[model samples]
Target chain A: MRLELVKRPQHSALFSAVSPFIALALTMIAGAIMFSLLGKNPLDALYYYFIDPLRETWSLHELAVKAAPLILIAVGLSVCFLSNNWNIGAEGQFIAGAIAGGILPVVFPHVQNVMVLPLMLVMGIAGGAAYAAVPALLKARFNTNEILTSLMLVYVAQLFLDWLVRGPWRDPGGMNFPETRDFHPYAVLPELMPSAGRANWGIVFALVAALILWFVLRRTLKGFEIRVLGQSPRAGRFAGFSASRMVMVSFLISGGLAGLAGISEVAGTIGQLQPSISPGYGFTAIIVAFLGRLNPLGIVAAGFVLALSYLGGEAAQISIGLSDKAARAFQGMLLFFVLGCDTLIHYRIRLAHSAPSKRTDVPQPSEPAEVA
Target chain B: MLESILITIATAATPLLIAAIGELVVERSGVLNLGVEGMMVMGAVTGFGVTVTTGSPWLGVLAAVLVGAAFSLLFGFLTLTLVTNQVATGLALTLLGLGVSGMIGEAFIGMPGIKLGSIAIPILSDLPYVGRFLFRQDPLFYVSILLVAGVAWFLFYTRAGLTLRSVGDNHDSAHALGISVIAVRYGAVAFGGACAGLAGAYLSLVYTPQWIENMTAGRGWIALALVVFASWRPWRVLAGAYLFGAVSIGQLHAQAIGVSVPSQFLSALPYLATIAVLVLISRNRRLTMVNTPACLGRPFVPAR
Candidate 1:
């Protein structure tokens, strides 16, 4: 006996739309089983994991804060992924952005001007874009694999950041700790409402970025080029769209956003350059990009969902004594289920007695026949 | 002093050689598993935990291999049976491994580990320069060399290897020839997983002999890059691994010698070298394309 995936004549749009929900449902079921195995009450664990995080005003603010970076990075990643350009080193770009944005506050700690914040943001974007261009240039000029190159850069960026904080950029009066001095008031990102919660302009930046990306991806000719080029580069070439140019453009956009996210994280929340600023936001955003089905608007919702999981993970850790590792495993499981369910959007799984006899409908040799 | 440094390089290179060789086979069978780092960390934690519990490094090694293989099976089920996107599924596998291993290893953290002691072959071990570097190394070091030799022969000389390569080169043709592409791929992926697990075990059991969160660090990723750097050849993987090992160890040595470069920059050397080697090797498109698994990363579904 064998099982096979038969390609659908046309992908089910409805399933494409609903697949994320299906995946989330499956993940919850799996999470329940995991909780049971861990000897926790499944209902209580589930509530803490999914619902409890959103119940409070403060938690909701935290959710927005966490979601800001994910949405920004995921939005950029959606553009890159859609164009078949993989930029797995958004983490590196994020760090670069933070480092770049921090130069003003770190080097000129006494500066106090309104333009400081705006200039820092621009520098952050530029830093990220410049860093991303390394892999982009390599892919365009030499056809090197972006996945490997981009990922390798992540470690480099990390080590560089570690070095700076521990050495050259270390604060003079920080009591020997490996961190920079706190940003001045003019350099810091002001909170949205000082009295309410910790949420700041980062969330606002995420929303604006999403809206702009949606317009660019859906209503513009460049958007059409990206969609066409991503689906079929050959077709894109015939349409006069340069794949190499798109590679650069997609990478720059993604890297720029990632950098923006990094600086926002530093200025808005951390308030200082440190050894570890991100909690894998760049990598987590990859999940968000896919979860949102690589759509900018969809990414906004997906970002919030993932952000909630991070908060829930903390909650579960405190309340049920669930290990942080378990929370990560839960996230990984969600991604696995998401990818599996996504397969259902384009293919139908069926049991077959044998391989050769079951695949008669597809006459084209180019199509994948049986996935068993 | 030089011989000791060489020994350190070899010890560092062993894990990479083992992991890359396993991945080489998986890629030869046309499946690209990007979760090597995740699997390696899973192995590191599992091996440490088991060794600490059982008081036997062998059991720890065995458990690590099993855990790694099991993790790969999850990947196989998704990519092979469910026909999920290989890249996405591989990344998910990695995330899952890191998370699960972290959870399982929480208790084991800070616990002292028993190292897998080196073997000494009497006169050979006592011999001057080459003695400690070769004959007196840990059992896994010799195993890694043998594994490389065995894989090189198996890939180039055996009929089964031919089938695996054919499956990787073009799965549809291999399927038409009754190669059982899916079965071969599953076996290959499992083999890769087991090797990755063994590498992880080497880290905790021999390298550091203690449990540390993410102790494997980015070595798993370096292994993946080594496979590409070798252009899918076993001998080249051996060379690449050792080169990487030297660069990694050399950085520490440089820092110790006060090379004036920041220790952080020195620490970043191995990763930077990986990028450089990739760029250099990939510059020649023909060489890369020739040895490259033609159907690599593509989801294979057997049909008539």
Candidate 2:
């Protein structure tokens, strides 16, 4: 008669595996509610929004074009996020990389060699890493908030590009517009299958990078060190791994990858450095990284799914008169729902002032942990 | 020239100072609410809508505080009650805030703002240099200064602030010492939200006297940077905000003076200044480790 029933949170390895699926389900349910609020037929709208677009060959290529950078950036970001070193300035790095990578093509316009393209790629990666180094140095040296440093640096990078496009990088012959000269034919990335739309070697790079990162994070000594550094700096220190050094290295790697993505973008698709080259791919990749739980392979899959939403958003916009802004709102909604569900997974909910007077009865039972 | 630049700097500093000081408090109490942008935009829209409806600037400010605080409560609920990752949750809140604010703000695009009037001083207004410098400014500017001073006092002098700081520095230890870490964080978050709202309201009602899409445009992010530059001190936040505001408005002065740099480069000035200042201040690890909130951006989950 005195037996007490204990209420404990359920923890299974399977739960971790299913979290993203649950989050996606929640997102769909929320999307349905939003659609109904807008007076649209939820199922029909959903079908057309996601499926109708995929049936198109052109749309498939566009999805690849969009997902290419996202996958590349998110893969790199997984490394940083897993190490617990946030580099929110990937957007800046991306911008800088584009400027740097595209510089050769725009400046030389006549460089007609295979080696030129490879050199441009290297330059782009270096450019992004250099830009990223600003925050990384400040972080490693002064203990500045990397999130802010990196973010603030984004505007600087952006304005610098704007300045370049309108000034030195401006095409003198191309009628007063703020864009770089067209990229050389040699600079362009060859299509994968010769006719797969925008699907090119960039996707291949993303996949390869994801695999390498996955291997490095899951099955390597450096990976183990990064995990330890993120989880506990004191422990990392005891293990003789310098936190600042890791911070620098992680930032360089992340920035360099983002740079590579930026160059790949300019060379692969648009073939020029245009203002607003990315639709916030660097920022969106943050969501992709977290949504896939920071696993490289998981991020690769997550990148495609998120890319679908972007494609589907455009589809809905054109068909149902939904604005591009609304599509952005939908993306934001997806991120929000995923975050909300993530909370549910990590912590169980409790009803306050209800039956069963336990610790969960009161409010704010779940709170943040110490930095350590 | 100096007078105009000084005025521009002061005007520019108002909203940012409000936000940075507010973030200082939020960070002090163990939360990194990156949703400042979202809260500010929501405040801007809510404030604009209220001002348009009631024709009262004061009510607009009040509306902003309410909306911002309400939005911030979402952050509190998630990190405090939901035990979510603080960084991820904060990012989500910012994105959600931006989307929702943008949606709500669509109605107010291109609307004219209600301009706030200044208090005319008698003697000080008549003086040459000191007159314009010390007197003849709007009530909000003065209030913002007082708010900074008040915040500085409250944070350092009051016992309540001690508890808040204790909670931010080490919530678990404070919890063991009989402090409600959850409640303190809630208070800090709400306060931060209100401040962000005030910053937003200032934008609509005073800064430009109109509502536009994404007008805050990284200003919230700038305010976040200012907090780091200020080293979590209220007075330092005021100084940092003014410095940044000066940098923002300096481009105008430089352009007017016909500086050789391109306008785009001039626009990049404030961002460059922010990076430079962050580097200067953050390089001192011992100082940073001491000044920065021990639990800044960390989520706390109580054991069962």
Candidate 3:
């Protein structure tokens, strides 16, 4: 008659390790049902979505390309989320990074030097960090909710980028289209290997960032402080850790990485700044961060898995006429299952025929409750 | 010109007021659902799709409310029943809504929608400058106003409102007092969803009268912020929504008038105003603390 979640004395480490796979399996089942409802062959649709993308060498390279920005952003987000700082405006930060990094090539087109690429990277990092500081400053100084402020800034950043590409930064010979001029050879991120595919240094950046973050999170004193602060702010304060400072640090790291991802996307893949540079990579990274259990190395794997879904979505669209919305829905389903499975890891579901009568023993259900 | 501008502002503010009032009640009941945007979009698509097919705006409005309520039920299951992380689950609901709506709305894109026409109240509608702006408007506009007043009275005067507020203020205390915390929260979330859906329907049936992918854009998010800006008060939500509506429409006027500012800057005005208001309000910590649901965003688990 009634169902309840009873917290476990200790979460099973084995289940925690295996939960993502269980979630993935459940999502696949749900996706199959969805495809059937859409009047498509579920097996063929699933294959195109989950298998066809990885069959080609070129698609594999494309997977890496898409995964790079996701991994880079998710790595930073993992730090922020782990430290109890929610930075939902990574999309804005990414755009700001792209804008900041593109300034050199867009403004002084004649500049040709080896320093251009390095300077652009620095600008991208600084731009993202500076943009992130808005919410961070508000949260620290005025106690404004970072979740809302950070999210609100995303719209501002998006509109700002739109203005730049349409008005001032529009390419002179672009036929009045909303986009910036393409970067010169010196400014562009070089390909990792011309013979293989279009994959570039961004993936390399993602890997290195993941490695560095893993070390910092697992081995450093600062990492311990972040963990302590996240678990209990009161205890963290007693241990001489400042919540305000941690907010700034986590935001800067997250924002800077997100910015780096933005610039890398422009310099490496897009080659020119446009009204829409990302296909929701910043937002998708939030899913990646959670899927990875807020672990840097785990995020690397989660990033690739999500990237595969994008490729699969495209593949399904071509093969079985799947709508882009279906792909997004599938991703959403994956996140839901992931959260659901994670809940199971922490609490066991119990069904009781009769409701309890006392407050001390599993607070009594007033009536028969449905499972939603 | 001023009257027309006022009408436009009122039209824009209507959906916001409806949605924010719903969220205010939900938040007051101690559940924070960030899926407003997702629910709104779902409402928009469903409302548009149904109107296009059924040829009746009322049916479309009804369909949207049901869809919104259904969508919120998913959130209720995950948060209240499954006891999942509220923030993550809410975000998931949003992603699902956007994706599912997009899929369902693919065929409806570019199709003209049936409008929910304005109601003309004879003499009241014919009054000089205030006539059309106040009396002659879409049925939903009046409903939004009534919603504000009704919610304000219910929250302040009704016993059910007090119970909901108590449940939100401290779930543990409310639980001990035999209040069905989960049931009250489910109702609150469902109400929020219905309001969000109605807002979305207003967009498709009255605002634009056509389906566009992500047509709700970020208004759902803006609605969420408006709740905080209003500090969870129904009347304050009305003022905040109108102010936001003015800022949003004012930016377009500025662009049309060729003000020195770039159109993009003007476009960002509403969001900027939200941040500014948040900063100003949050500066007075006492105000936020007093009104903010103490159990907001926290998972409620009954112990044995």
Candidate 4:
């Protein structure tokens, strides 16, 4: 059997709205089959993987904690992607942000005040943006492929972080652990509701960022510029929009957000800089951005869904002896479905057992229209 | 000692050469598959698992190749048939490959690996340093060299190769002339997948001979860089691969020498080198513009 696609006269609004949900449903079905193949009862695994994590108050807090970074990083990514600037190096920027933000508490341990937290947050945004600018500058100046350059920077960032914690930032008084000194109370991000769980102001920041970006992307001229440039560079050029300038704008926005996520994760969740601060949140945010359909508001919801998967992975591991790695696989499959389902918005698919019949009775798409 | 080091460098270079050559062909046919890392890791895990289970290194290599090609079909289906954004779809493939490979390789971790032995050509193996480097290397090293030459010939000399290149340069024209653009792309993608799988197998079966999670590391991405560095030429890819191999192996040797520089700094050299090479190559705009496949990464739907 061969798959054939027929172009629709216009983009399907129904599919545009419904594709994500269809993708999610398809992912769940695939997950169920995978669970059964692993010798677990499909229904039980499904519940544990999806529903059980949301059952309790503390787990809900955990979800908030996990969702914070994904949402924060993804909203930024939404801008970069919308502008057609692929910055896959947000993972590195996250690390750069963590290191930059931690410099305050790690190096200037005596300067504990109300100002330190805000200062650290600013430093983080600066650090992430600076790290991301390497690729952006290279692309703007030399027309380098941002995807490969950004990705290579991820490894460099990882190594840089490793060197920092193990070399310069190693806690001198601590037992030689590869981590920085714990943040003083003033430096730590305050918890939202201490009695419930460890969730902090990070979630609030994430929501605000998403809300603000949603407005900019929808209600502002800059948003229109990003959309126009991304959809058609030639048209953007004709409209006097500089693609290079847009690259810098989108990259800086995304990188700053990713950095904020990084510092927040460090100061709020871990309380210090360490050898590793994320569980692949930067890379995972790429999936989140796509799953969210490149809209900041959509990213907030998508972020929670991805967060649930991380929680579900841990839950399944403890309860059913499934590998936590399965969660990553599940997320990967979700992105595949998301991309595949998106095809429906522009084309209708037909499964043909033989060559597509060119029956004279069937109406055909008129001329090729001189596609460029 | 120098001979041994050279051999190690060759070992390191082989997989990158093989994978980059395949990708060069795929790009020549006008598809940019960013899933090489994903497909390569899947290959590594499958190869190690099969070799460990069957105790036949050859069979392991074969399984990795097939699995890699099969995994790539997912990418091919989404990007080619479904006409999804190629960049996004490629990233999806990488994510899925990493996730699925990690799950599949979980069982194979910590198990002893069976290393594939080098083939010794009679009499030629007896020569001093050059013989072992050239004749007594593992089977895939020779395959890597042959692949570069074969791909070079196929891409530049063959009628099918011209057709593939034409499709990459102008798919609409190819379609106008009744060439099956999608079919050619699918074939190129599968070939790239098979090469990536073989490269992954080389990692597990010969290089380290173990099933380590994310073992391919960033070599797959490096291979992608190599394709650009080579300007889509197969032989240049060989040169680029060997250069990277030296940088990587030089770092290892530096660490062994107990150089004052930190190990992590040394470990980061290859990635840094890739960035440097990319900057240098791309700085020459004419070089890139003249060689780049015109239709690379663009989604094509034949309008009837």
DockQ of each: 0.58, 0.45, 0.57, 0.58
lDDT of 3 by residue, A1-372 (tens): 788676666777877999999999999999999999999999999899878988877888899999999999999999888888888899989999999999999998899999999999999999999999999999999988888889889889999999999998999999999999989999999888868888989999999999999999999999999888887787789999999999999999999999999999999999999999999898899999989999999999999999988998988888888886787888888899898888778777778667653434453322211000
Worst 10 residues of 3 chain B by lDDT: B295-304
RMSD in angstroms between candidate 4 and the native structure over all alpha carbons: 2.4
Residue A84, candidate 1: how far off, in angstroms? 1.3
Q: Which residue pairs of candidate 2 clash?
A: A142-B282, A142-B283, A367-B299, A367-B300, A367-B301, A368-B299, A368-B300, A369-B299, A369-B300, B113-B209
True contacts kept of each: 0.71, 0.53, 0.71, 0.69
* DockQ top scorer: 4
Q: Which window of ten consecutive residues has the lowest lDDT sum in model 2 chain A?
A: A1-10
DockQ-based CAPRI category assigned to the predicted complex of candidate 3:
medium
Please, what are the lDDT tens digits per residue for candidate 3 over residues B1-304? Answer: 9999999999889888889999999999988898999999999999999998999999999999999999999999998888877777888988889889999999998898899999988899999999999999999999999999999999989999999999988888998898989899999999999999999999999999999998888899889989989998899999999999999889888999999998889889889998999899989989988888888877787755
lDDT of 4 by residue, A43-62 (tens): 88889989999999999999
Question: Candidate 4 docking category?
Answer: medium
Instruction: Please give, for residues B47-117, the per-residue lDDT of candidate 1 as tens digits.
Output: 99999998999999999999999989899999888877677788788878888888888999899899999
Candidate 4: segments with Cα more than 4 A from true spot: A357-372
C-alpha positional error of residue B297 in candidate 2 after TM-score superposition, expressed in Å: 2.6
TM-score of 1: 0.97
Docking class for model 2 is acceptable
lDDT of 1 at A311: 91
In model 2, what lDDT does residue A64 have?
A: 83
Q: After superposition, how far is residue B155 of candidate 1 from its true place, in Å?
A: 0.7
